[model samples]
Target chain A: MRRNRALLILLAVAFGAAFLKAGSFPGVAAFVPAPATHIAATTAHVESRFASSKLHTQVHAASAIELKDGTVRAFWFSGSREGAADVTIHSAVFDPQLGRWGKETVVASRESTQHGLHRYVSKVGNPVPARTADGRLWLYYVTVSLGGWAGSSITAISSDDEGLSWSAPRRLITSPFANISTLVKGAPFLYADGTLGLPVYHESFSKFAELLRLDRHGTVIDKQRLAAGGQGSLQPVLLVQDAQRATVLTRYSGSEAPRRARTMSTQDGGQHWSAPVASALPNPDAALSAVVLADGRWLAALNNQQAGRDSLSLMLSADQGASWRVVQVLEDQRGQAAACEPRIDAALRQSDLAVAHAAPEVYAGYRDSARVKVQSGGACNFEFSYPYLIQTRAGDFHLLYTWNRVFIKHLHFDTAWIEQRLREAAP
Target chain B: MMAYTDLTGLAGVAFALGVMLSRLPLISRFAVARSWLVAGIMALALLPVSDLSLAGYVRGVSGDLSVTSLLLLGLTLLSRAHPQRQGLLLLVAGAALALYPAAMGLGSFDPYRLGYGGYAALAALLLLALWHWVRGNGLIVLGLALAVSAWALGGYESANLWDYLIDPWVAIHALFALGRAGLAALKRRGGAR
Candidate 1:
């Protein structure tokens, strides 16, 4: 009996020690590397546009790509509110030289998706378009049939005429269980062999990121879960370092305070991934975009503030992603010089909301209240979030994000502009 | 387009149905009938009926039961010979209680997350299987050994280790069986008094 008692006590100690060792979190510095010395020219020519119709009730999850003709085409979903049946995918094109956005047009509607898919689409969200190596534009968007966002499934449509027209939509077979709960957000990574790596996430039964490896024909051939079993990470944005290596930054979704973004990397292509680790950067639980610049510098546009979407900052990293420094404050609740400019023109023949049949008094009241708040040093928490960044062949950075949830704002800048901002901010 | 992983789960369900029917005294009279019935159910589950496959129907109802639940069903069916019924029920009950609450986010720690090659849960399961082996309960030990091997060979759709260990179905069933056992024990004590 005494021998058995001793064995039990020893086993208890061993189990306790094992539990303690399992609970420790991985350190961030081990995953983050050292900084590099030089970077690309930071000067930039800045341009902003309200790509969506200013009269729309709400707009979000905007994505863009530069066509072969050098025209910047962007798309986002808009309606009375998100998840509304009447919501439709709205798109617009910007001429870089003219610096003006054309009229927004309805590209993909709920009825059109239903006709193409042969199933009922309750609503649509997160439309991401990527131009393949052969100049074919592949647009992937999310459709919900049964439940909330967790019931989302991705559908693919191609544009041969560069956003002018599209092919019939086909659902990507991502999951065997009715192909539900998979959604795409980050830009697709186009490989040399015409294969595409789309970063998607599952929100049903599990909140984890997955990399869907698709054939050139948009068929899902393989899938690898990123940060599998980790609860708080999703919407992974890929930043390629080489042909076989890349870094994925995921948005943390858990209810933990002081939310920070999650990070993972792939070395042997997308077959295997390092376990996700918390990054040093603070996340306000909002979507952010990252891109590897021509000179190998990393650029990210994110809500730098810890707990609010009111401030969006463009940040640059020299040595991979080991460290990040704020390059420019794109928008902040405190103020942007552009925000102070008069919103209502002197010739007030009509208001932007008038086209939507919205109450002008209510619209004007909200607008006046916002203006008063800004002028009184109490700027309303107008959100500038869900940034999507892409680099054109000319090496210019094109960024699109939501503006106060009212319009999809596009910002164009150059590497020289980023360098100048970093220089000025440096002591 | 149904994948092979989705179709294979029905084999366990068909086998379970056969085992349940064979346990009845009237059905057990014909020995060969049980094997034939199990084979027929498995064949039907693999085929399409009225445009909908049997696997599709089962997936619709169960939403893809975990590999663990399927293994548990197999062990329960086989354990009638070895008769470690109480031990197996308690083991399943413990796993279910440990996993479901954390999976539902009742705590900060999720054992479901551990289903993804989690070391602690794997170690605990290994120890439990070893205990069953020492007690000469080969059915459950065989189940655990096969589950681990299937996980290593990528037998299931999900790469998660927890998916092969415990799911909500097995957890709920185990908890109910344990509750019933507790009630029976209390009744026996009252009758003796």
Candidate 2:
């Protein structure tokens, strides 16, 4: 017994020495580069158009990034139905010189993704494109190998050229159990050392937000949970305040009252995070988007109501999200978007009368076109949800969202436009 | 690396399915010997099922089996060391209870994320294994040593160490065994009374 105790002590010493040698965190000589340059506002500019051409019957979860030549490329998933076997990842480019969005192109399909991953992929969705610090563009999206969305795994495909060609999809080995239920919806950001931080959520059973720190080669080095229990929040939109201080605004999925957006922050380059707390925005169980401008104000494009996506409001926070006030109603159809809402029944009848009076063929076409069924358990004629917000290097805010489940609507506005509106709504 | 992932997955599938196959009445009756039965199971594990082998399809559903799970399943099926298993099952069950709930984002701290950096969890596991070794638990020590070695080898596609250590299936198996052991102990106590 005495010799065994000594041997145990020796083993403890050996393991302790190895632990000290291995260290807690990597010796990442923190690179402190400014994230974005301050491009001045000009002429209160705002450009609005559709990012996705009317190609597939459904499109949602759009993400964008500024290219090297100052053009914008937006990415989203489209198919006859969400999670259908034919669902694919698609992208379109916005030319600043021409002031127009090009035709949408298929970036990845189910067949190509399965071929690259060497596994059977039922579907793919939520393509988020971001330019890494090394000038390579990486698109991270979710692919379901089995079951439903809860069986998701994130796959990354990169492009060396500016949104022209893509590499084969590679599945990120994230989970222990079959690598399932890890989904990506937020914009991936860069750390001081050029490492990438991808905000992802798990919906296997408990819903919670997590941040994954990846090396420059897209390998996950560390991961931190951004919420407590994580059952209440998901789809976190990341906003970096500085090199070390950053915040994440998550969509509330909890079953409690008030139904506000959840927020979690990190002060140590994501090594640790505070417990998530409810932000001052009414989430209504919808995905939202946010971006920090060069001038230090933050903008979130989200459905601000407590019930529906009939109105997407542009909310501004000057004090780094402690307080918020709606600047503009970007899309407010009131009760016009919902088929189940009793308030929209009168207008729905009038619209039906107008379509019916025009022609029988026109009424049939309108009825077919106006049919908007979302995976969120509702059929509505209009829904403005799944907004993804990003600010270009040229100081323009592009808010892209799912417009009625049929189009990815892009709302472009310059810093000048934001500044002019902020001045008008100044308290 | 992906080929290595596929190989590890195939092996895991084979052994996991091997345990199930050995229990079948036909195979058990035909092969009275366990070695022959296990060999036949390994041979049949390579049967193709579409894009993957039979084991590959099982891996497609259960993900890749952890190294510890693979080894434990192998040892219990191969070796006749039944005396050491009860302690190992209790240890695994206790660990699974600590790990699974916390890994699913039950709180602010996530134990699974430690698999990425791996220093802290590795030290903790090393000490646990050492304690078991001092207590003469050879099977538990062997399982931990094999899992850690496999993780260091990087033969599996997962970069995380937790994926090599324990999985949901192993945890569930340990829990079920522990329950059975407890129930039997209660029965014996009742019979004594």
Candidate 3:
């Protein structure tokens, strides 16, 4: 009886604790946010600039935010090459008035990351920087201590003075399976309650996207899967329609043919999501970004090709995300544009004059910096991928993406310009 | 916030490294090998390898050691008590097959994501531990109880219940041990024949 009593006590304590651990922390209903009701100064505008100057040999995955003074700060990872030891996260300020980008400087490196985290960091990449509701700038990037991208985790650091200085980096506990395989790509958005919803994805045993709801301090409070399984989606780009309605566009990685971009929407403020359905836009398994227009439409920058990322365009979706139509050919490197470089020495001019005009000297420098990355299967490739889009309070769309895996091209267009393009696409 | 994570890493590395050092011939010759092993464990935790401790580097790659893993490593430390090896091996092997391959994106359900929402899996664990406890399997019962209690206290960095229960290393070792046991059983039958 005594032995049985002791066993019962142990079991009771553990069971009681387990019941309490069921942590049904009264599902906090999604706070209804006051609709974003700011109409910016409607000036027709469109311009292009390279946010990253001759700072690093290779650069990719650029995300940007408009500062308080209206200058744009863009962040991208650069190094001798991707995954190289010298790889570091760098940023630049885009002074729209001057029509030029400030000098690029390294923000986070492997050394700084390991030092701040107090752990061994093998590499870091894919910076997703955003302004929190409380006016601080938070940068969430990918970190790996072992293996490839499959063994990745998300690390976050914040700057109170808008990218002037940073707090020590802390690893976000995203997964239970050794906290491995959570990566950031899409833009993080703010909740009505000053919390944040960071869109992340799993690349380990699966290729599904997840939404991690974090408190103000960056602690993950909840996670909701946008899709499931390897056949699901990756790199989600979110757009909010209202307090309870939101949509997510993802890179389709399905086994089936007729590969279209996958999309899902949440009706209950993201407590759950409808199954991912196929969108009309073709997805060649690449990353993309979207922003909500002042007029309530959504615009996305993506490589619209079925095979290569050689063609990038802006697609407008007037019906939330049900349909999409290309309003502008942001980049077209097909046909003659995909010509082999003439003798490696002659200045490599882009087929698109806009890109050529944006950076005549960029092509000359890219050959030496990212020679190996641009060469695919012994062919010279024109590439544009990993688009990051943000709409400033002044109703300007700032789109940034990798230019030939060497430069981060920032495209600035205003709401008036977007309206014109949308009107032209109208039937 | 990181102390619990670091402490768990330290304990795990101590047990694993201590057992490994105890196997050295020079150390094994001594009657007080364990004492020396304990001292060595402390040094390994504090001993910096490129500024971070050896244990910290291991933790960086491995993340937190699951309760099951720590318990298994501790078992290797204590002198032989192998009464429940078959049952534990079977459980580990079965869980690895169920959780890993599917969680790798093969199955419809991630089962791993079930870690964050709540501890619905704990009830089943309670039943399993109870049966094991009735059968006098203190090691398995204690491991399960401790895992639940630790997770309940919310000290772990991960909110997932599965994280506390099993990790990749423990699962892989369990499969290897089970496979070895099967081969040994086959050899015994062949010898009998």
> What DockQ class does candidate 3 belong to?
acceptable
By DockQ: ranked, best first: 3, 2, 1
* TM-score of candidate 1 versus the correct structure, residues matched by position: 0.61
Better of 1 and 2 by DockQ: 2
**What is the CA-based DockQ of model 2?**
0.43
- Can you tell me the DockQ of model 3? 0.48
lDDT per model, in order?
A: 0.68, 0.76, 0.77
True contacts kept of each: 0.00, 0.38, 0.48
Single out the weakest 10-residue window by summed lDDT for candidate 1 chain A: A25-34
Candidate 3, B123-173: lDDT as tens digits: 677888888888877667767777777777765666666777788888888
Stretches of model 1 off by over 4 angstroms after superposition: A1-43, A334-379, B1-193
* Candidate 3 residue-wise lDDT, A1-427, digit = tens: 5665576677779778877757543355463332464765676788776677663378889999889999999999998878887889999998888877888888899888876665678999999987777788999999999988888999888999989888878788777566788899999888877778889988986788888877776767677667767656998888887888888899887766677888888888887788888888888888888877756788899988767788799988888777888878987667755346552222223322333554646554555544555665687777889999888776677999988887788888877787788787779
Give candidate 2 misplaced runs (Cα > 4 Å).
A1-41, A54-56, A336-368, A372-380, A423-427, B28-49
1 or 2, which is superior by TM-score?
Answer: 2
Docking class of 2: acceptable
lDDT of 1 by residue, A126-187 (tens): 99997665778989999887778887888788999998999987666455334467888898
Q: Report how far residue B52 has shifted in candidate 3, in Å.
A: 2.6
User: Against the hidden reference, what TM-scores do the models get?
Assistant: 0.61, 0.86, 0.87
